[model samples]
Structure formats: C-alpha cells, structure tokens
Target chain A: MLANYGYSDGSGDYFITIDTQRCNACGACVMACPSQVLVTVDEDPNDPENDGPVVVAHGDRVRKLRYECDPCKSTANTTMPICVVVCKTFAISHSW
Target chain B: MSVDKQPEFWRWDETNWVNRDIEWINSEYITLGIDIGSVSSQAVIMCDGEIYAYGNMRTGSNSPNSARNALEFALEGATMKESDIHYCIGTGYGRVNVPMADRSVTEIACHARGANFIYGPSVRTVLDVGGQDIKAIRCDEKGKVTNFLMNDKCAAGTGRGMEVLSDLLSVSIGEVGDRSFDIEVEPSPVSSACVVYAKSEATALLRQGLNTNEVLAAYCLAMAQRIWSLLERVGVEPEFAITGGMAKNRGVIDRLCKKVGLEPMKTRWDTQLAGAIGAALFGYSLCRKGKSKRR
Candidate 1:
C-alpha cells in the first residue's frame, strides 16, 4: 500500500509531515519507521510509564524523508511498509 | 418379644435424642467457600469457629473447574472429606459456575465482608486489584456496601499487566514487587495505554539499552496511576484495605499510596481469600439466624 506513492529527492531537502488531528495515537508509524525517528509523547504525570511522544519519520522534505528511507523502500518491493499498511485509522502517510 | 410382637418402628428416647443432638453440636464440621476469579481461584474451609484450611491457585483459561480443584486441594490438605462439609459458598467472576456451592455472592459484597472481618468495623474503603479487574468500593459503618467503581474494560492496571511484564523480563511474578524496590532512575516512559502496545514500547526501550528494573518500575507506576484514577472517581477514604492478587505487588502498592497520598491498610491474612471468607461468614451468619428463629 505504501509503495503506490513514489518519493523523489528533487532538491535534496528532507522532512516528514504528520497530521496530528488525524492521529489517534495508534502507534503504527512508530513501529513502521525503520530509523526509529518517531516517538509518542507521554502526558500523564501519575503514569510515568505512559508519558512520551510517538515516533515519526525524520527529515525536512517529503521526498528526502520517504525516498531515502532505506528500510521501508527495501521492504516496499516485496512487502508493504509496516506503518502505512497497519494504519487502521489512516492517520499517517508520506507527504511527497 | 416374639418377632410378630416387635414394633414396626422404634420410638427414640428423649434422653438419647438430646445426647445425640449434643454430640452433633460438639463434632466439628468444615464448610468450604470457593472464589473463582478471573485470574485466580481460592478455597477456604471454616471449621469450629476457625479457618481449618485454604488454598490459592491460578484460574488459567478454565475458571469454574479451577475453583473446584482448588477447593478439593484445600480439603485434601486439611485432611478432610468434601462430603463432610455442611455447605459451600462461591464468589468472584466465575462464582456462579461453582456447582458445589449452595449460594454465590458478588465480589464487591464478599470483599467488603472479608476486609471488615479482618480489619474490624473501622475500614471504610476497599481497593481490590485482581487479575483482570480493579475495584474501589466504599462501605458504611456496618460493612454494608455503599458505592463502588470498577475497571474491567481494560487490562492495563490489573495483575494480567504485571504478568505480561514478568514474561517480558524473564522474571517470576513474585519477584517483580521486591525487585522494583532497588530502581533508582526514572524509567524511560512508555506511551501506550494498550497492553499489546505497551509490550512493544517496553521492547523498544530494552533495545535502546534501558535497564530492566527501570522499565518494570515504570510499568508499576503506570498501573498505579490507572488504579488511582479509578479510586479518585469513586472517592477514597482513610482506613482503606486492599485485596486481590495485585495487592501482593508492593511496588504498585507503594506507588499507589504515594499517588493517593495515603497508606493502605493491609493484613497478614491472604487477600485472595477475601471473597471466600466473606461468603463463608455470610453463610454462617445466616445459619445462626435460622437457628435463632427456630429457638
């Protein structure tokens, strides 16, 4: 599913955009990101365990973030990117 | 007397009847109570105004039968026969499935009664953290249940959550409470509320070279927070008694106490037997009432 969209680093700039409004904090992107860039924010003070931000893709441009991502690209040919494939709420997507 | 002259039925002597009645009263009889909870089953036997025997065992997937087995084991340990028991009472999630029980009671009522029995009449609140559920109940001066709140929809704050962490850490569940005492640094936070997601989060932390104790301590803190939220919603009072399997987890209890700003009242008596003990007490009280009415 993630491979349907192609990313090209036209200007060598990198960034991954996530729409927080659409994010349900389901953690699909955190698990799918091969570089371990995404992190979930922990909100509750009483709950020290559950207090952190989720992991997201790292970079400034959509193409650089998505195309140069070696793990997802390598796995994309034979298998769907884990984050995009497992997104039950469709909260995440590569910007470019 | 001739065979024909023998009475068809013999009449009992009043003196002999009274003597037999006295003997019956003197002989000790054991009554069993089985509590089949979501995570565990407990059996207790009350004999002659004392607790003769008791046993605790995991409920596994089949809870009803597990309760029966626990009861049987307790009876065996006490060197008593099942048929010798006068009555059986059942309580907890799978209480209704205890085929041998003459009656079944709710865990809330049973826990209140059990705590009240152990702690006397002063106890006002009971916090029961079982395998799959957490309950905070209030009681009146007479130990009657007032209002209560429960968290059964989620496994995040229950014994099952600790079990998951225990498996992940490759440590026994019994060690989790004591091992967490030495944790110095605050663990890297785990952000997921879901148990499955929490496991992944713990794994991620481990991959990052986080200490296992730190991770375990964080898990305990999270569960305490979840439990505290539920307790706060119901309104907690002093002299609060904790019961159920998770009550044995001192790490969680200590964190919860700090979060709630009050120390919980606990007893040497097994918390897991609270339901069964309460049921037996209720049964005994009812039997006494019946005798008084006859008199």
Candidate 2:
C-alpha cells in the first residue's frame, strides 16, 4: 500500500500528485481540483498532450514544509491514492 | 534725393525674411494623428494632400506604449523627425495618452472622419470591430457622428472571440478567414457567449468530428449575428463602411455584407489607421481655421 503524505499547513498548502502513466488526461482530476492547482499540461513545449499535473516544488521531498498541492481526489480502483473522495482513477491517497 | 534718405536695403532684407516666414507659417504643414485601439495602434502623418506615412503595431495590453511605438514607427517610415510634426491629435481608447496631441477626440468621431475621407462624404454608416469591442456608428453628410451603438461587455463578436476559436482549432488567426471561406456546410451550433465556454464548446465540436472550416464558419457567423444585432440598433444606411482590425477578416466581412444587404467599402490603406487619419484631418482643419483667424 502506498502511503500518501497529508499537508498540515493552515495556510492551505495542500497539493495533489498525479502519475502520468495512470492519467488518461480525461480531465477528471482537473475538474476535481477545487483549488485549480491541477492543470492539464496541454501546451507544454516538449510534450503538448502529456497527461500529467503541473507540479511546483516547494519543500524537500523528505521534509514537511508549506506547499501548495493539487486538490484532486483519488479513487481506490487503481494503485494510485485518491486525493478527493470522487477520484475515478483511485491513483491518489492522503497520508501524513 | 540724398543717399541717406533712401530706404536701406538691409532693412528690406529683414522685411523680406519676415514675409517669407509668415508665408511658410500660413501654408498648411503636416500634422500627426495617433490612434490606440484594443488590438493595435496606428499613427498617420498627412501632408500636401497625401498620407506621408502610416504605421500599425500590435497593442500588447498597453495602449499608451503601443501608441508611442506606432507614432515613432510612422515617423521613421516617413523619414521625418517627430519635431517636424506641426499639430498632433489623438483618438481611440488610449487616445488620452498622446502627450503632444492638441486635442483628443472620440473613436466614433475619428472613424466617421476616416470612413468619409475614403468613401466620400456620403457615407452614413460605419462599423468598427476591433480586438475587444465592436461599434456601429451613424454620421450625417458632414461626417459628424450622430447615433451610435457598441458592444463592450462580451467578447462574442470581437477580435478576442476569433482568437479563442483560432487557438481551439490549432490554426493561426490569419488562416481562419480563408478556411472559413471554404466551409460548405453550416457550422455546428455554438451556444456559449463567453470566451471560455465557447472554447470548450469548440473543443467538443472538434471531438464530434466537425471539420475545421465548418467550425470556423460557425464562429464567424456567430460573431456576425452579434454585430448584426448592434447594427440593427443604429439602423443601417447605404454606403456603409467597415473599419478596424477585424475588418480584414473576410469571413466576418462577407457575412456582414450578406446580413446588411449592402457591400462594405474597405480601402487599401490600413483599416486600423482610420482613427489616426481622422485625427490628423481634424488637426489640419483646426490649424487652417486658426491661421484664417489670425489673418
């Protein structure tokens, strides 16, 4: 089971991580992300139609720091953890 | 007569020089006009019964900067310095920023003047569609603006609307006109009036296997319909002239012609420069009047 890291920032530093291999670019996560953090990389110069969420590095991977994450929920149907309750991919999960 | 009593030739030289200076002052000199519109800015210099120079540049979210750049470009195009400009007039959304302008006139007035200048004084109706707004203005025989209507709230029929559609179709704005000309079938219905919604609708239409030409034609028709509604408010008249950035779009131009039941007159000169030309003409008129008064 993949443990998802939960954000503790009261300033709303939540983020949603997406696995490009699993994402279909069906816009499910884009629609589910309430904070508008999860955007489809539609116009990437290198990869125009890459099915991945735009990521921004805030803190070290191992350390806990204030970071803004995608608000998209993940579903349990796949190996990915769910970020929201209605994720269809089950690719996103929250853990602290 | 004594030689001392004769008028001095040196004094005559000064008098002749003053008279020549007065004559030069009385003669009409060139004037500059600047028009800063939503999508582009233009500058025109009118001298000796012809357009000495004209410059058009994209207005990238800053009207003032665009106007200045256009003015500088026009000056350079004419191979003349800015200090040679006798009078300056400004028109359009950013007209107020023309620092050296003698007066600032409304875009309606400028468009009217420009249209009348090209199509003669009989032109009564003018349609100006720019990047962000659309306007329908009616002018009297003298080229003074009378009744007018405009659409400034939505991006439905403006240049920005076409830009959104162009992006959705993965085509450049320049290609939309020619492609729409080839559309044989009626375009799919586009329900959204907002740009974002319309973009999504366009994407959906593409997914449904609609051809690019058909979709583009549909967008043009939608924009033309909105413009038609605005024109209806002003009451279309004969000798209608269309001017602005979007006037170059043959798709919209042809649609407007069919809807209005009259062919529009478009000049070879830059359509976006209409406002600037009008301002320059107005400046020339003011200078002429001032000179007559001083006489």
Candidate 3:
C-alpha cells in the first residue's frame, strides 16, 4: 500500500513516498517534523486494499515540501529529511 | 528618540526579565536555552531542573546578537557570568544562528518539553501561536513529541495578523484582545482568510460606521475560527496547553477553548518563554546524562 505524492518542477523532481505496509503509524516522524508537513489518516480500519492508518502528506504540502524540506538538506549530518530518520519502521522515503 | 512621537499601534511592552524565588548559589549544573524567534527572543537559565532566571526581549535584526542580549539581560540582576554556565542550547526559528550555543534543537522538541514543565506531566497537547506561525503538537507524558502540525507559511492565525489589525485600528496591540469583548454582541468572522484582505475589509467596516471594537470582535472571531480549523486537523485532546505570544490574548484563548470544548491547562509562567525553557531543560538533562555516562 505504498503511496507517492508531489511533482517535478523546473528546479527538480520532488516526491514523498509512504510504504503503508511497513508503517506502524507511531507518528514519531510527524512529531520530529519541524514544518508539520505530514499527517496520519485512517484509510479503512478493516479494508484489505488499505493498511488501517498511515501517515501521509497534505495535498497542500506536497508542492510546498520542495521548498519547505530544503532546510533538512543543508546540514551535513542529514541528507534526507528528519521524518525519514525518525520513522523507525523505514516506511517513508523522499525523492528530490 | 521621542517616546511621545511614537505610535501606540503595533507595539506592546513585554516583561524583559523574570526569576523564581530561589538562591542560585546552592544549585549545581547550571544550563541555559536561548530561543531566538522571528519577533522575539528568550533566554532561560535553569539550575538542575528548576528555573533560576529568564529574560524575554524583542528580537533585533541580528539573531546572534538577540540571543546574546537576552542572556545578558537575565544575567544582569543575577550573580552569574557567561562562562559560569555549563551549557547553552539554542531553539526556535533562529536556533542555529545563536553563535554561543553549544548545540541546537528544533522548536518542536523544545516546546513539548517546555509545556510539560509548565503544565505538568499530564499535558499531552500544545498549541503555540507565534509571531509568524502556529504549531499544534501532541506529546507523551514524558514530554517527547509524538505528532504535530504547523502553519508557518501564512500570516493568519499568528501574532503578526493581530499586529496588523492593531495598526489598522490605531490601537495598542495589547488592547486588541480586551477591546474585542467590548462589542455589544459577538460578530461573525470576517470572510477573507488572508491578513492583507482582512485588514482592508476591517477598514471598510469602519468606513461603514462600525466602531473599532466591532471590527476587532469580527477579526478576533475570525482568528479563533481559523486556529480552530488547524487544531481540528491535528485532532485535540484533553490536557491541552497553549504557548507563544497569542496565548496571552484573552479573546482568542476564550473563543478557542469554547469552540474546542476543552479547558486548556493554565500556568503562572510566561507562555512566550516556553521554547527557551524547554531548551534549558534539555541542556540540564543532557548534562546529567553525560555525567552518568562517564561514571
């Protein structure tokens, strides 16, 4: 139940990847996130196609992350956003 | 340089320094947190885990200077030198800009810890409406962040929006909250969501013969509603507490609490100093951890 959101602009390709199957929805990433870009949603509690509850980016933030997430990239300790680091399940990834 | 010539609009006098009733010389492990924010800065000094002294001041053009000045203000009345502090951690929008900080932590982490300290361990939710942004955070009993949401890109639901309205009505920013309640009836929220549009609409309302209090009531209502939407997205729970500058606005706080149907936890501590206090607490914990690790 992996989901991808966002698009490529003139600067680069930006995308936030969520692997629902691996996600436990502990929401540590959401808290670690400085910009509050991610949110948790209950797709369907008992549905087979969807994994109960998973974190996803807002429709509005998908585009804004291209600029919003840039601060995470500036530091040497982090190449990816802090959300990816705090996501213990390794369910979320970013493409830039 | 003439105080009489200055406009009262968009300006409010903030308490520059505060301290707990205690003797600092008796405590060990002194740590500090300098929070250099968009519109203001705070420096909090802690002995062990208890607050010793703090300073809250308006931020100047230079971030490092703001951080230093805040620390100096706090230390002015206290018997401590800059070199006597064990560690300095910076938090807020300008966290990394604090040249004197030994390290830095994000505002999210700092706010959660600060809220826990002020409101007790029961606090699970924190809503901070700062100068240029708003944050809704959910944390655990231990004061570690679990989930959070922020509205930083926009001016609405922030202190800047209230400042704009104050300037428009030619009233002191501090009086806007109290004046909102002076209206005969509760006014419906303004239609425009953007601060710029809302400001113009408020001006037009005045032109239509509505009084300043009425226009202010309308804006306050709108602000409460706007913040309510953001809080809804994150989901609200009991034991909620609010931080940052907007928490002082009685109108917004009362309206927000009524709409959410929950009483936000109260505190005697200054709400704006939450971030810096949290940072100082972090420094305190870190120092203890390091000492234990060495042993």
Candidate 4:
C-alpha cells in the first residue's frame, strides 16, 4: 500500500508517500526529518491486520507539510530532502 | 462585516439517537468513539460491536469541550456512565483533543470502517466531505483503507464553502437542496474552485439577474464537479457511500451521483456519526484483543 500523508491546498499538492511494503520501520527517515514530520507506529493505522512497526507521516504535521518542508526547498542547490535521501530502501517520496 | 441581519442559516439540527433493542448495560464490551470535526462533533457508544447510542452537534471553538459535550449529550437518559466504557477512540480533525479517549485514530480509518458498518460491507468507496476537507477512501470489506486521498487546504470542496454561499445568499442551509432544485433552468457552474472567487462569481450572477435558486444550482453543480474529479483520482468502485455534513445536501450529492453514474447507497444511521462509530468499533476490537488501555 502506498500511503499518502499530506493534503492538497490552494498552493499545490504537498504529500509524503510511504510505500508500506518497502519500509521496514528503519526510522532513518524519522530521524532525518528536520520538522519532526515522520514517526514510526507499532502497526499500520490504515491496515488493521498488518502488525509491525511502520513509518508514517505524523497526523498533526500533515496539513502543515507545505510550510514545514519549505526551508529545505528554499535552500539553493539542495537536491533531495534529508528524509528521502536517508531512506535506504527508497520507500519515501515527496510530492511538492 | 455586518453582523445584525442574518440568522444562523447554516445551523443544522444537533441530535442524538439510542437503539432501543440493545441492552447496553448487560454488554461486556462498551466502547466509545468521539469524532471532533472542524464544524461538528459526534459521539457514538457501542455495546458488543452494535451501536447503542450516538450524538451529533455543531462543534464549538474549543475542541476538548466539544468532545465532552458530545459525549454527555449521547449519554443523556441512558443507563451508562462515562466510567463504564471499556475503551474510547478519538478521531476526526480534533481527535487528539478528545479528553476521555484512550487512543486516537485518523478520520480516514474511522470513516472507512464506519461506512462499512453503516452502509454495509458491500460499500467499496467512501467519500466524506466534511467542514474543511474532502476524503476519498477505497476500502475492503473489513473497512480497512486500501487507498485514500485527502484535500484540506482548499475551502472550495468543503462544507465551509457551502456555508459561505448560504450566508451570502441568505438561504437557510437546510433549504439549499430543495431551493436549488426549484430553479427553472440549471445554469452552468461558476468556474472558480476557490471560495473567494466563487463568492465573487456568485455575487456577479445575482447582479446579472439570476435568482437565488439558480445561483445556488450553479454553485452546487460546481461543487459536485470538483468533488467528482477528486473521486476520480481515487478511483470509485461499486456500492459507493457518501457521509458527513455534505451528505445531507441533495444539491451536491444528487449532482455528484449523476456524474458518477451510480446512486449512493442510503443509510438509516446519521451520516455524521460514521467517524465516531468507526472509532468506537475500533475500540471494541482493541478491547477484544486484550490491548491495555492507555488512559
């Protein structure tokens, strides 16, 4: 399951898509997130049957992603975000 | 802004219902679900997986108070006390603010589960248009979300957008659907998806001599069209269900159904309670699994 954890506002789409199958709850992305936007849960909230730690975007921070991720985007010459770059399994992607 | 002229036209009835058939006091697992939405709040109590009682009311500015009020309202005249509940799950935009909740779940999960319970197991697609956001969810028979998308940043597709129009037109929210249908000819929808632009466009149409109902029809159609595109992105399936404040608006649902080419399944349960009910049901499952209460 590709869980999208952001909202589309007037500005544009701001989402962090987490591929549940590929993510192993490594917490690399969670540590790399500058805004504390990502966290690991004991079970997948969207899938009741799936038990095991999985990374998901923090609920309260979802609506604020456009603002929270702005600093990284504004930094000139910066390529990918730290969260995306730290995911060894390449399970995280951003839609800006 | 002038404050004196209009009544609370957007005010919908705040209500509660108790299932007479369920002997809740004797049930082993009593769980509560509180969904504190942006515009309204709901409380639902389940006894052994069946809905025993529920309450719905407009949300106040303070979310924690709204949660308490909703729960108290539902518990009124019932034999159950707040302390008797085995577990409670909070959901919706204000889920984290529910004072008595043992845990919090996202509205997306709760709505899908609640839709499955209320609309039945066949419902594959759930579209919840709440006060400030739109959620399109694809779920399995068990009500676990498979795919979902949400839009909250824009007011154009939310109930708040409709409320703004209702106030601008001085039309009671309750009468919007019937009045919108009373028009002689359905005008093309206002082109803007932004609420400010739509409001301006609506005002312009009124200046152009279109009646209130005609203008309403245009806005409703536009809202339906916008919602339809969101549903398309999530991919609608059979046995689709619509819930939340917008479900009561025929002006929007009828047009949306027409565009989707499938009639939405009807529910006897109050559509607003779906989130709370799902939260309560989740609490029930958690209790059955012997999960330790957090609170």
Index of the highest-TM-score prediction:
4
Q: Residue by residue across B1-295, what tens digits does model 4's lDDT show?
A: 8777648877789998878888877898999999999999999999999998999998999999999999999988788888888889999988888888888888989999999999999999999999988999988899988788887767676899888899889899999988999988889988865677767988999999999999999999999988987788678999899999999999999999999999999988889889999999999888888774523
lDDT of 2 by residue, B143-234 (tens): 77665544454556888778777766767777677889796677744664456576787777778888888788877887787778667756
Residue B152 C-alpha lDDT in model 2: 50
Question: lDDT by residue for model 3 over B112-183, one digit each (tens)?
Answer: 889999999999888998988777777779887666655565667678888888888898888888999998
Winner of 2 and 4 under lDDT:
4
The digit string of per-residue lDDT tens for model 1 on B1-295 reads 6565533111111110011112223444446678888877888777543566777777757766787788766655244567777777788888778888876766767787778887778888888988877777777666666655445545667887787788777767777888777777766446533466667877887888877887888788877877786677557888888888778889799888987788888686777778777776665654555521211
* Candidate 3: residue pairs that collide: none
Candidate 3 stretches greater than 4 Å from native? A1-63, A66-96, B1-4, B18-21, B291-295
- What does the lDDT read for residue A59 in candidate 1? 21
The parts of candidate 1 lying over 4 Å away from their true place are A1-96, B1-30, B291-295
Alpha-carbon lDDT of model 3:
0.79
- Alpha-carbon lDDT of model 1: 0.64
> Could you estimate the TM-score for every candidate?
0.65, 0.66, 0.77, 0.89
- For every prediction, compared with the true complex, DockQ reads 0.01, 0.01, 0.06, 0.48
lDDT score, candidate 2, position B287: 72
Best by lDDT: 4
Whole-model lDDT per candidate:
0.64, 0.64, 0.79, 0.88
**Superior candidate under DockQ, 2 versus 4:** 4
